[model samples]
Target: MALLSHDAGGKPVRAASGANATLYCNESTAGLSMLHKELAQLDERVQRLIAAYRQARLERKRALQERDRLLALNAELKRRIEGVVERIRLLESDQAQ
Candidate 1:
């Protein structure tokens, strides 16, 4: 049978037989160490994901800015072409007259 009691911290503590207690303690410690390692790995993965998200957002913003600049350049080119066409039309009319 096991002894059950509350420690000073109000947490229930278990008292076990000597050999069994030793085996259980070792296993618990190993399990806790494994849990800590797994948590550390998860933390690393989360950090990497956050970094990737930030990089993607920055790339998207840069692409948007590039698109806007290209659009403005296209509009400017169109306006210049229209002005040239108007000048050519006027010159052709003067020649015809």
Candidate 2:
């Protein structure tokens, strides 16, 4: 007798295939049912954790991209400000001549 049976979605459950099937008591069946429930719950939690990890990875990538953009922008602004300050110094020197 096969020790397992599958549902439509191919999930396995303990089963007895032959005449001795009724030998399993209600308590054992209940225990098996509880174990299956706990396993399913764990599976769900693991999936949720995996999804959260992926989201965090994407957020990190986005943050890095934003940081690169801001760094470039800051460099450009500093260069422009320095040029403006040099021009002001040159103008002030020329005015004093």
For the record, the alpha-carbon RMSD of candidate 2 to the native fold, in angstroms, is 5.7
| Cα lDDT for residue 7, candidate 1 | 60
Cα lDDT tens digits, model 2, 17-92, are 4554655435457868998999999999999999999999999999999999999999999999999999999999
Per-candidate Cα lDDT values, in order, are: 0.88, 0.83
lDDT of 2 at 47: 100
Q: Per-prediction TM-score, please?
A: 0.83, 0.74
**Model 1 clashing residue pairs (backbone):** none
Question: Among these predicted structures, which one has the highest lDDT?
Answer: 1
Residue 27, candidate 2: C-alpha displacement in angstroms: 1.5
Task: List residue ranges in candidate 1 displaced over 4 A.
Answer: 1-15
Cα lDDT tens digits, model 1, 1-97, are 4644456699876757888887767776797799899999999999999999999999999999999999999999999999999999999999999
Clashes of each: 0, 0
Which ranges of candidate 2 are over 4 A from the true structure? 1-24
